[model samples]
Target chain A: MAISSFHPPQRTLMGPGPSDVSARVLAALARPTLGHLDPAFIGMMDELKRLLQYAFQTENAMTFAVSAPGSAGMECCFVNLLEPGDKVIVCQNGVFGGRMKENIERCGGIPVLVEDPWGRAVDPDKVEAAFGANPDAKFLAFVHAETSTGACSDAQTLCAIAKRYGALTIVDAVTSLGGSPLKVDEWGIDAIYSGSQKCLSAPPGLSPVSFSDAAAEVIRQRKTKVQSWFLDLSLVMGYWAGEGKRAYHHTAPVNSLYALHESLVMLQEEGLEASWQRHCDLHQQLKQGLAELGIEFIVPEGDRLPQLNAVTIPAGVDDAAVRAALLADYNLEIGAGLGALAGKVWRIGLMGHAANQRNVDYCVAALREVLSR
Target chain B: MAISSFHPPQRTLMGPGPSDVSARVLAALARPTLGHLDPAFIGMMDELKRLLQYAFQTENAMTFAVSAPGSAGMECCFVNLLEPGDKVIVCQNGVFGGRMKENIERCGGIPVLVEDPWGRAVDPDKVEAAFGANPDAKFLAFVHAETSTGACSDAQTLCAIAKRYGALTIVDAVTSLGGSPLKVDEWGIDAIYSGSQKCLSAPPGLSPVSFSDAAAEVIRQRKTKVQSWFLDLSLVMGYWAGEGKRAYHHTAPVNSLYALHESLVMLQEEGLEASWQRHCDLHQQLKQGLAELGIEFIVPEGDRLPQLNAVTIPAGVDDAAVRAALLADYNLEIGAGLGALAGKVWRIGLMGHAANQRNVDYCVAALREVLSR
Candidate 1:
């Protein structure tokens, strides 16, 4: 069967992730494929690690991108840190939290989930209670920003509580890194994972993750081997974190890493704090415009992720139809509510390069037209 | 902290994998990033599956590209197929085979290894004997082309032996897919994985994998969940195999898939057999030139992979120095030996788009110049 080269339609990506990759990042992806171990590529990898440390606001020394997407990043944390029969106190606020539970279970770890409402942040009180109840829980895991519901949990507080209990904290920063104020080192996050597509505005595939020294020490002392040979950090770090001579773990996604590097470089140029403010500023603009259209956010104002706005779908409105109209009429894309929130909300994203006045105006106008129809 | 956009040096990649990606594929990589669930993107995914099917020469409906590298692809096969305590007759002829064993143990499956010398093909007799010794062995895994040592095993013979033993066969076709003859359905291979970087002329991220009906059945009937949350075929299939409404799994590497699609399209235009012949013909050219420079093939001639030339470094010539000079003076990248052959051999790749008369001539000339020094 003869098939031609694919030319994807240009859509204004205002979805949960993969939000409007800049021309620079896309161009970087098209650069010549390099050998994974090439000195020049290795040099670029070092720069990439430094940039990731900057994005995550950490100097953890173990920050690097997982070869796969954010889902794999979540798995990386669980598999490396938890052996069979290990206990973790996990907080579930939205879709990603449930996914974390899956990862924990798949790692053969007992997950004592501290449940919360879908659009609400992880209650620090409940997390504390859960840890208090399961005093043997060695890890406390939670999402900093729930992409599914656009809720921003109190990471600093949650981490502080975990630390008080002598438990390591694994944070899912997929929707928070480079889009909001996520201070990994300051919050004392034991481990964290983020998505390149979400706030970095790179093509989806690579997952940027970081680990605290405590988490590293735990992995080092683990009695059992990490279940995933591919996601094993001990082997992975030999390739990513080594100096002078880097051991080959697997052939890295050289071109995708180039895109990630360029995206991180863009994040560097804009500056992390400025990038966070840009996302917050644009969210306010979109919020006002959505207010004019009688749309309401499902997440409360104080605990919302500015980059991912989970707004309630109007009564009697067709979720699929509205999203289709946006795509067909305006070449725009918005996320349908995932998991429990399905059909109830639309996730309008203002991430990275897409967090600008033009996209905000375009998205709001498109939504208004679609809703009017 | 200061950083600039990474402008990589233009080098001719004649390494083990990440073989020279064509301009068309690289241009496709630079194309606009589309949302993972975009209808247009879904349509592209369908075409991509068909292309992968064509490349693997399989009619299996479950064929698709894994979002990670080849190593992850290997893990996906192992985790999905083997339940804990299952016995797999694994053949180790080179580096990837050893990696497969690691994956087997990580999945809690017992790997009964059938060994062969590193630079030699996996002996089918030894594989048959292993199955004979362990009649309970239900799985047989081996690499068709050993990337580490340029040894091309007899996959057809090995699969036939496994079929005789009533075992499912898993084949690693990473370095063999487009450059050499590989017929998945004809060989009755149950599960096979290949990399986009090798012979496919794509960037080094995606791994194209196919599962026969039998392999798919094994995954379906498995009682335990696949240990890898990211690599689980059951959940992964919901996203990849769905016709109308694709379930969101992980965000696929969108732009990288664009490059993979374009590379496969180019493979389609140049028929698979013709491409295989081109690699073989170029190998002959490179072989003759290497012989002129007093270099000897490490693997016996017949067993050697045409796309990857594993030749002995000239006596008294420094392996690092020659490879370094090739990069420094000629802007050429040939792979240094891996594992057991580390300092003894150089892996000169003639794979995919790099399998041309000019590249063969350039690589041979560069090696000759460095060796003479």
Candidate 2:
């Protein structure tokens, strides 16, 4: 059996990421594939690390992109920092937070769970209380912007709380990096990971991550070898460390890095704060439009994420049917609620290149036409 | 500080892996990005699996591409199959075999070393003896093609030997697939992994992997959960399994899959045997040219890999200076030897779309001009 070339249909991606990539990033992905060790390529890699530092709002020397997706980035943090039998304070409010617990446990770390309702922000007081109860906890982990429920937690407050307990923090900034204000250094985040497709406007593949000096030291002093060699920071650092003297760890996803470098360059052109405001502005426009259509949000206003808007499914509406119709009729893609919120809510995303007045208006108009029928 | 878009220099790639990619694969990568769960995207994914199956020459149901590079693929096999305290025979011929041992030790498995010379294939007699000494060995791991030394081992004999001792086999075919005769099913390889950049002529990133039915059964009946959640086969299987009813694992490298699909399609069009023969033909041309220039191969002819040629550096020649001159003067790239062979040898790759008479002639002509200077 012979397989032909795949020509993907043009899509308006406003779902839980891979949110619309711009033509610039796509063009970058088509650039000639260079040898990973080529001097010209290494120059671009150094610039990429600097650009990633700017996007992450940190001056971390350990900042680099993982050659895989976001989940691998999460695993990298857990495996490198936590050892067998270590204790961690894990906050579980949405799907990604649950995944964090799994990472912790798989690394042989005992997690003390801090639970909150799905559509609400993680309760900071509860996290503090859990830390107080489990004083032996070496790390605190949570998601800043929960894509599953569109709830935004107070990262600054949580990090401060963890610091007070003498514990390091691992923050999942996958949905918050460019769409929201995330100051890795100012907020005292020790280790943070974000996805390229989320708000960077690159295709889904690379995970941009940063570790503070303190976190790097902990990795350097690890008592046992990292469980996942591919995600191990010690070995990976050698490859991503210096400009000309770098060692070969693995063949980087060359084209994917090209796309990411372009996306980060675009991010620099439009300043970080301006990008965050754009997301907020588009979310406001979408909110007003949805309100006029009698749609209500699942998350409260204060706890909501501007990039990911989770809303209640209207009574008597067939959730999958409506989403399928929108895709079939208008080529618009929104996300269905995952895990506990499945069939109960719809997640509409306004992220990076997808966040604009035009996309907001088109999504609102498409939903109205499909729902009223 | 502002940064401009990166325009990478166009260089002829002839490194160990990440060989020259075709215009067709690059164009496929630049196509519009799509949602990972979109129906049309799912259709492409199903097609990708079928294409990968054809490339690996297997009918195994658990065939798919890992969303990372080859190292992650190596981790995926070790973590899922071996558990804590499990003993395995690890054959070491070059850099990758040592990496496999590190992976085993990290997974808490004890590695029984079966040592061979650096530039030679794994000795099948030594492997059989190691299995005899360690009757409790659960796995026999070896590299089918050592990219570091340009040696190709007899995968058929190794797997057959492992079977006789009631041990599963893990084969690293990173540089062998599509460039040589690798019959996954006919050789009875239990688990195998290959990189997209090597013989497939796609850009770096994405590891195509396949597991026989017996290996899949062992994974299903594992005593403990897979150590790394991101590389967990049980959970990943759910996402790659089923047609149109797939579950979400992580967001796949969407555009990378497009490149792989195109590469595999090209491979299918030139039949596997034809592709292998192309590499062989190009290798012969390169060999004759290099011989005239007084270059000597590191590996014996019988065990040498046509895709990767490791040649000894001539006495009194400045290795780094010559390679740098080749890059600067002719816009060409070759590989420096790794590990013990570093500075003593140079690796020239002839794989996939890079395996052609034109590249061979250009490489030889460039090398001769630089060396004579």
Candidate 3:
């Protein structure tokens, strides 16, 4: 049977990511399409790089958005930096770090793992020890903020540890880039990737990424070609370089990029530190409300990500049932726990445009109403 | 400097792909964002698979849109099907065909070349002879419609030849899906990938791909892990499978899928055969108009893709200047020939929503005025 046009419901998105998009971003997304190489389009692309650099807190010339989602962005970092038989130390605190291991193994790199519990942040001491054990390791990789659990690692300390070990740093900033404090330059992160949907609150297609000059050099000096042609940064750079003339790569997700551009523009307007503070402020309001409802967070106070609240599911509260009620009755969508945290916690997100008092109070009121019954 | 919201001009997109998107599809794209795992979103996704099956003219359960662009879709097919050291006959007639060879080699598959000149269809006789020489060749890969050169190959005959040799067919339908007559089941194609921006008239980002049951079986039994975690079909199918409960793969590009679903609905409403015929009809109008202006086609009439017309630049007519004037003065966009045909041909596309009498007239008139000036 032929399907007609899909009209999705206007749900209040407080999920792990894909936080509520703003009106401005949606309007920008609906703009008329442009050829990827149109002069005007190219001009917009140049502006996009400047905007992305500002959001990422990096002045790296190689910074740009990956055409796919964050997983591809992670692959771009891995494939470009690590060639066959290369040794790297990886910190696995949540789901994404495991994905990084898959990328490493697939690209013929050996991963020396520094393990952490599901809801806890990566221990920098353990990461340093892993590098110490594998002295020949050329890279140290970790997630800046684990979306599976709302745990923010100390990226500055991790990068410093890697630097001490004479290794470059690869950071997964998918859930933290626009919602929290992410200073790519100050943190000395060599390579990083973030999702457009998370914190950026654009559509869920593009992955913004950046590489330091030292990281770009690693890619240039690689002995083997990048395994995935689509994720190959060497070829991708020809198109995204934003110099005099842009080479044609794949069709840039034109409309999606427009949405991302708008999101970054909003980020710039709010000021990076201000946006981070907004998420923190809203997170505190939600926390107090949840506390009144007798909820306890899974991650420790100091290590937790303000943008993503991971609270323990109350005893015998029926996790799926409450979530279903929230969706069906309140039109509010929260996250189910993933991986090891499954059925144990509810992830409430206050990200980007969704990071405001109105959303936070609405979420708490909705949760209270749903949970009481 | 901070960039504000991007407002792309409404250009008459007559490019090779990213053909003009209609107002309905753009409106669908701007609809309220839903969580990727929202129940309503899943229902829409199920509907999407059904509509995609209608568009591809197949009943394969594996039919769905890849969250990335066409190049990633191309990689998805290659990575899933071609195991290490597999011998495949790659027919190179255009830029995409050469990309397939890169995919093959990158995946450790040996590519036996069946060379065809750019702007020409793949030769079936040479393909058969090549297969005769390499009886162990497991796959026959070729482009059904070459976007770079505006040539159309006989997919039915090519698939038949591959079937006769006990080889599977991997067809590049990136430019052929809705704008041409492509019957996946009738032709016994093992795998096919297409771009939403091409004949579907959806904004770019998603690549709709389908796999025969036999092809799916090959992926299920692969000896080695897929090189790129993002392009891995085994994991991707977990989310796109439209079953009772979905597994989390990567976040689906929610908004882009909405646009694709709308485009498929429009195709279904118009009727597939009618849409194909409409493109052909518009091509006739464009062809006659271009001929009046003494514009000669790069591909022979018999082998040309009606949706994309590759015409030679008039003698001493500066290619870049004419295109620039067309864009600046008339707000029209056309494709310049890529790879071997660059600077020699202007690819005039009558694709999807852009394939209409009004657009054809505007394009020809714009060219005539630009050239006269």
Best lDDT goes to which candidate? 2
Clashing pairs in 3: none
Q: Per-residue CA lDDT of candidate 3, range A238-322, in tens?
A: 9989468888878899999999999999889989999999989888899999999999999999998999999999998999999
- After TM-score superposition, the amount by which residue B134's alpha carbon in candidate 1 deviates from its true location, in angstroms, is 1.2
Candidate 3 local lDDT, residue A63: 88
Stretch of 10 with least lDDT, candidate 2 chain A: A235-244
Q: Write the per-residue lDDT of candidate 2 for residues B177-268, one digit (tens) a residue.
A: 89999999999999999999999999999999999999999999999999989989999988888755878899999999999999999999
TM-score of chain A of each: 0.99, 0.99, 0.99
Instruction: Name the lDDT of candidate 2.
Output: 0.93
Worst 10 residues of 1 chain B by lDDT: B364-373
Give per-model TM-scores.
0.99, 0.99, 0.99
Better of 2 and 3 by lDDT: 2
What TM-score would chain B receive for each of the candidates shown?
A: 0.99, 0.99, 0.99
Question: What residue pairs are clashing in model 1?
Answer: none
Model 1 local distance difference test score: 0.93
Docking quality category of candidate 1 according to DockQ thresholds: high
